[model samples]
Target: MDLHLKGKNAVILGGTRGIGRAIAETLAGEGANVAVCARNAGQVAETVEALQSRGVKSTGASVDITDADALKSWIRKAGVELGGIDILVSNAGAMAQGNTPEAWTQNFQLDVLGAVNAFNAAEPFLDKAAKSHGDAAFVIIASVSAAQADRADSYGPVKASLIHFAKGLARENAAKRLRVNVVSPGMVYFEGGIWHMIETNQPEFFKQANSRNPTGRCATPQEIANAAVFLASPASSYTTGVNLIVDGAVSNRVNF
Candidate 1:
């Protein structure tokens, strides 16, 4: 199905790797100009090059999402470089896991503040696209853990906040014709960086998660990218303020 996304411009926070990178690739493949930002300057440059090779005008920047001012400036810069911003994918967060209180605090700072900062910075650009341009949307990448709270530092609450924030923003901006939505992903594995910890340190727990999932395994970054594309594309023009869950039924299964 044609997503009707050609020529549109997007800013994907933390799009240097993992799911964010996947989303960037998917969007660029759909013919959208994409700009991604992450702290790793090298990875950011590599991703931009890879996207451009796909024939989409793309750029990359090294910015920390947790810093509000820096995030806002980057968003503005992306809009300028991409020509305009039609989609904002807030996907630059990490699992805050540590056995200490400081670890938990850092988790909230990154998870919650990161999402909030991205949204706040992108709001102006999103509104501009809807009013000045034609159709535009905001797709936020959250996690199924938001619904399950079984993750670190009650990380569930942090993601849950993003889900709710999308809802509220959808409502607030609907009159302006700007759409906001959330995509919740279940257990996903890719490069094996984060997964190494689970598979190596908590093999039993990892086994249970795979068995619980209906597919008997985890989803891929590409799978989650498909959902992000849907939300950000014209295909979902009328859909907004909705939490689209793509968890392979892991969140729905009965846990005993």
Candidate 2:
């Protein structure tokens, strides 16, 4: 399906690798001009180059999403390069699993404030895009951990807050014609991510994790990206203020 996405512009945060990278590639493949950001300049440049090779307009910047000014500056440049943003994918985040105060603070900063920064920076561009494009969208990459109580990590509360944030934005933006939605993925396997940490440091837990899921396997980044593409595209034109769970039915099962 074409998804009617050609020529649209998008800004993606934390897009150097993992699920964020997947979302960038998927949107670009659908013919959207994409701007991606990460902390590492080299990786950002490389990912931008890769996207460019696919015949999509692509740019990258190194910015800390936790800093509001830095995010605003980067968004301004990206909006200029992409000729105005039509879609904003708030994907930057980290898994802070420690139970200490410091870790809790770090998680909130990245998952909550980082998303806020992205939204604030893109608000004007998103307004412009919706006024012009008529089918503009904003997609927040949340997690199924938001709905679960068993998560031992800091990811749970952060994701839960993100869900609320998306809902609030959707409520406020519906009159403006900019659609807001959330995709909550579960147990995604990406290189050097939580899956790798589990496999290397807690093999037994990894086995149990897989067994608990009805699919008997974790989700791939591409699968999560596919859901993102739908929300970002005109395919989900009426979808707003909803959290689409892409967790292979694990979230639906009753855990005994």
Please give, for residues 21-131, the per-residue lDDT of candidate 1 as tens digits.
Answer: 999999998899999999999999999999999999999889987788998888888898988889988887767665467766666777677777877777778888888
Which candidate gets the maximum TM-score versus the true structure? Answer: 2
Candidate achieving the largest lDDT:
2
Q: Weakest 10 consecutive residues, lDDT, candidate 2? A: 247-256
Q: List the residue pairs that clash in candidate 2.
A: none
Q: Would you list the C-alpha lDDT of every candidate in the order shown?
A: 0.84, 0.88
**Distance (Å) between predicted and true CA of 234, model 2?**
1.7
Which residue segments of model 1 deviate by more than 4 Å? 98-100, 150-152, 253-256
